[model samples]
Target: MNALIVAPIVLPAIVAALSVLARGRRQRVGAALSLAGCVGLLAIALALFAQASGGAVSVYTVGDWPAPFGIVLVLDRLSALMLLLNAGLALVVLVHALLTGVDRKGWHFHPLFQFLLTGLNGAFLTGDLFNLFVFFEVLLIASYGLMLHGQGAGRLKAGLQYVVINLVGSTLFLIGVGTLYGVTGTLNMADMGLRIAALPTGDRGLVQVGALLLTVVFALKAALLPLHLWLPRTYGGTSPVVAALFAIMTKVGVYAIIRTTTLIFGAQVTGPLMLPAAIASVVIGFVGVLAARGLREQAAFGVVGSTGTLLVAVALFEPRALAAGLYYLPHTTLTVALLFLVADLIARRRADHGDAITPGPRFASMGPIAVLYLLAGIALAGMPPLSGFIGKLLILKAALAHQAAPWIWAAILGTTLLAVIALARTGSTLFWKGRAGEMRHGAVSRLDLLPAVALVVLLGALTVGAGSVTGFMDAVAGQMFAPRGYIEAVLGQAAVR
Candidate 1:
């Protein structure tokens, strides 16, 4: 067992507990503690990422018990990447909150932030379904608090709806778990996969139903179309810092779908279910973005659309397509997260306009923000000379090999066009449209602005380093397509029947 394997989960848990106890004390203390936690997390993630990138799996069995019996934490390339991304995003979002006075909105904000990190890390590292549920609850609980961090009737209302929807998703998750356990007598994901694979034809009926139930729960989390109704309100209403952190939250569902389907259920059964939903999400996302009123709302809608496009890549189930999806995954996550903060920055300056499409005040930092917005818009719309273009190009190339190529191309390219149009309209409205007579300069915090800039820089880094990143994703896609190594790593070599 690698010592660093447990660090990802343990470090955050310890920080969360400390933050909880020191909750309402000195603001600086909380901030210092949270910063330390993120720094530590980033270190751990990099170490594990190096380890996993070598095609090695680090499994830490809890209480010295073996897998299929005791809890386990498994780190592979995909999960390691997710850990690194989450930690980096946490640090950036925390800095933004501190700079913008968002952490001051609630006493437990820092603690909840740490706890949210804990949940996210655990969900990626856990080797069992039940523990995944526990981690989901942990993060969701923290999210409920953070989602309502800033006091506002709008936030409160959105938070309540978010809570209620997740609560229902949780209930369905439990029922699905129960059904799966009754059939397989194990909660360990790898072991359950083995059992599902070896099951007789007649018994697969219930298992299929269970899988569908689980899919619905995950789909809701990923904000697939019909299930995505709550996102615009919840994500748009929250504080920008909170909304930025949440940029990766829906990906939890996407990750679950990718993991469960590819590793547990096999592509045959999962493909049929995921393909249609992915298509629906892309179409709905395009329509929603065009119809949205506020810039934040538009970004939120774009998230769903872009997510749908990524899932479409995944739904194809070919290694090439899946590899393309993996490449797009982090790119989409980072860009969407940055967009939320960008929206906040833009809104802060144009306070009177309130992120609406119409003209507004000439806020401070217009030049830098306009560039950031343009860069982000191009990436989000899959325009050229950026990581987004590369990701979409890869997906298109791979999808051409698929029988459903036409439909895939139509959905992704079509949405890309509509999204670009909507974004262009919004950009013109926000930056180029007629300005007020007297241009007022709003107070811009250097700290608040830095995080958004830093995020955009990272996206640029992705563009410059595309070759290396694409190679890494291709390897990850291969590993995902072949779950034999993962199963053997988790359940012991003998269990890889």
Candidate 2:
């Protein structure tokens, strides 16, 4: 179990190093190595998921040292589920990148992709705040490189914005960590939780401020409300494959919030800050989607709206409600990524027109790509017979018992309606309408379409298997809410008490 826990992190780092070593003329070999790493990661993630689904928590202590001191990695149901989702996404996106010939655009694409995987896997597994921050930096730096792989003025500009915003967020992360260490005299999450539980009332204000700062940083990464200015522009500007891979990046912030609040800070502070921010994000996302002039921008805003809806349930801090949110997480992530890839596919066919979402050239082999975009649009709007519908249903049903049930229902349902309208507009303009000028009949490669097709099929599978998945999520929720077991795993048994 310990080996499995450590393998996901180490495997990627090793592959990344190998890929980097195979630089220049050996870049083809590097891409192949990265692809192999992605496959291995998917297998390892699935194995971990299977192990954790049995309601066990696994821990790996670095350097054979004890907890609250040495580096530690912990895997419970939540982390395992995240690992599987991330690995699956990365694998599919890598295939898409290879198909699109984007992997060869720069010498470092393969190595950077592997390094990004290393960081993502590490962030999910790390049990301490310091290492979490370390993993975040690793991923961010790799992302900066990937974002600029194609090297356009627009992309470079967006990359700069991304770097600047994240640097500020990273600064806040360090400040929060420093304050946390000063207050609790520990960097270990479980130990921090124990200390926080017994915190002196006089110091509560100081700790709260520090925690709030951290929350803001995570929310920024999560793209909650006003902080979300970077998302649509950044995502829209990046290469389609890179954009698809970034689908999981935002969720890193979501993961941090879940792990830290439930395990360390409790939801008392989080709920208050997150609630209003989520509502605002929902409003802004819907507005942006409605206002979008292109398919890519609309999809970017669609992602933001979905994030808000996911966080709405999460902010409530109800176990069942959060399980619903958890279920929604992977579904939304995959759907949004599929949207990005499809947008790029359609845009590439149009060439200079570039997914304008207005009447344009009818793509050759329009049947498959058009069908995909249509279905993805429906799913993104939370329409019936898809996982999106089921996910929203779960969230709404769980929210019905809350005091603010009406607000929750009205807000979610209303924004979903707007989302439908926005998607409808995009679909009609892109696929249905015909343009005046001579159409560019660029041949659409079936290989480029394969990954998106697989994602759509998986969305269907998720819908059909909702019952089993939700049950597992319920069990995972049970493990998540009570942190004693998690605390004891890192510390000795009864150490937290």
Candidate 3:
């Protein structure tokens, strides 16, 4: 179990190193190695998920050091779910990149992708705040390279802004970590939680400030509301394959928020600020969607709005609401990523227009592409018979128990309506309306469409298995709220009362 717990991180790191060694003229070798690594990650994630399903919190201590004194990795239901989702997403996106030949744009793409996976896996599994920050840096550094993989002026500019903003966020993360460590004298999350629970009265204010700073950093990563201005430009500017992979990056922020709120600060300290920011992020997202001039921009905003929607449920801090948010997480991530890839397919077929909302030459495979867009749009707009609808339904139902239920309901429903309108407008312009021009690209092969189709199929599967998934999420949420087991597992029974 210990070896299994650490494999997801180490496997990707090893693959990334091998990929680096296999780069240049041997790019295909790197791609093959990357693919094998992703497959291995998926397998390990499945095993961990299965182990976590029994409600055990698995711990891996570095150098055999114990408790708050050393590096540790912990796997519970929540982390296991994230690991599984990330592994699946990585595999599909890698296949898409390989199939579509985006990987050929740079010799470094495969290695960077693997490194990004390594960081993501580590972030999800780490048991301490400082290590979480370390993993965040690892992923962000790799993302900087990935974001600039194809290297155009637009991508370079966006990458610059991305680096600058994240550096600031990283600074704040450090400050937050330092402040918390100063107050509690520990960086281990479970141990920190116990210490914070018994925090001295005068030190409470400093802790609150530190927690709020950390929340700000996490919220910024999640692209919630005001902090979200960087997202659309950044995502829209990147290649579709990279953009698709980034769909999971924002959730890293959401993951941190969940972990800290549940494990360290508690909802009373974080929920109030997070709720309002989350609501505003939803509004801004759909508004951006409505106002978008290009398909990729619209999809980027959809990610923002989806993040907002998920955070809305999360900020309520109820077990059921968190469960709803958890269920919504993967659904939205996949849907938005689907939109990005589908947009690329459509854009490739349109000469000189390139994902613009305006009418252009009719692309080959119009019928199939339109169908894919329709399905993605429906999922994004929270329409019926898809996981998006089911996720929204669970959230709305869960929100009913909160005092701010009316606001939550209004934000979700109203934004969903706006999203529908925006998607309808864009789809109508891109697919329905036609202009006199030549198609630059040929028919999209089955292989070209396979990644998007797989996402569609996955969404369908989610809708079909909603009951079982929600049940599992319920247990995961229950585990979060009652985290004594987590604390004990990490620091041992003697650490907890």
Candidate 4:
């Protein structure tokens, strides 16, 4: 089972090379290969999840190298969950791309897609900070190409800003990694944790600076505010398929913050910093949502708001709140992805207005799409009968005991109300006040709608299985707070804490 940890990284790397080779001969061959790879990746993720569910940390060292000096991939509940989420999201987005012919816009889509998977899987599993930096580059490089996949002035412009921002982030990542290594004499995360805990009082402040630097980098990636201006334009301008896949990309940042704070710095250091930023993010993101001029822009801001909401629970640094945050994380990912797909469908049908929130002619199959829009809006706004509602309810309940409970409750509920009004207004204009003629520039078929509907159904399933899911999350949170098991698995000794 430990050996299987390498498969997620290896499979995608091999498939990406094959996809590049197959790209020239026939696009279908490449698509089919990429699809097979995603399916296989999903299977591997499920297998790993099953292994992780047993609550044992699994570590895979490269070429039999010893720890603190070797390349290692660690899988516990957190990494396994990220692997599964990315796999499932990749498969669904790939299907949508294939169905909508979005992949044909660029010859390298399949290869880049596979490479992005490689990067994501590597980042999630790597046990060393330096290797995490390497994977971050891998994913960002691929994202540059993917962001500009369907080239246009807007995409090209947004893609350039995206590249520059990430490059700066990569630089910060290296600086932090260098600082930490200089302080601790190692890049291995578990080893660093032990060393930091044992470090003399004098070096404590430097270590905190390094940790905060890394947190800023992660926050930038997660689109947390003051650093989130890149998300709306980048996501809004890109193709819906790319936008949908990129939804999971932000979670990578959130996941990094969660993993590093729990493992290396301990949440006490980063928690206070993350809390105020998170609240600000929620406020600014919802403001963006309400002020958006187009549906895709609205969806993009919705991503920001949802990330803020999830991080609110994470910022609490308490086990129960972390569990609630974990529950909300995936729900937001699914909900935001669903909104992107729905937005695309609505936009494509209306030739004149595209995705603008303004009223336009009745498009082909308007009624069904409107219904989907309503469902997606409900999910986004955390309305009842959806996983969003349950996730937020759990978060609010968990925060009730905190001193900041009032502020957290106010931020979440107030932002939710903002989302509701924005989506409601968009729906009213797009559906109810349409012009006379019915436009059918790109009429959506059942197949085109499948991915969005699938997301809604997945959310429904999450709702139905909330009890079991929350139980699992509780256990996952427990594993995170008690880091001894993770440290021992990697370092062969009990954690100092």
Q: RMSD per prediction, one decimal?
A: 1.4, 1.4, 1.2, 1.3
TM-score per model over all chains: 0.97, 0.98, 0.98, 0.98
Model 1 regions lying over 4 Å from their true place: 23-25
Overall lDDT per candidate, in order of appearance: 0.86, 0.88, 0.92, 0.91
Tens digit of per-residue lDDT, candidate 3, span 89-200: 9998999998878899998998899999999999999999999999999999999999999899999999999999999999999999999999999999999999998988
Greater-lDDT candidate between 2 and 4 = 4
- Candidate 3 wrongly placed segments (more than 4 Å): 436-444
Query: What are the per-residue Cα lDDT tens digits for candidate 4 across 405-452?
Result: 999999999998998999999999999998777666464676788888
**TM-score of candidate 3 to 2 decimals:** 0.98
Whose lDDT is greatest here?
3
* Tens digits of lDDT, candidate 2, 398-482: 9887777787788788988898888888887877785645556765577788999989988988899999989988888888898
Clashes in each model (backbone N, CA, C under 3 Å)?
0, 0, 0, 0
RMSD of 4: 1.3
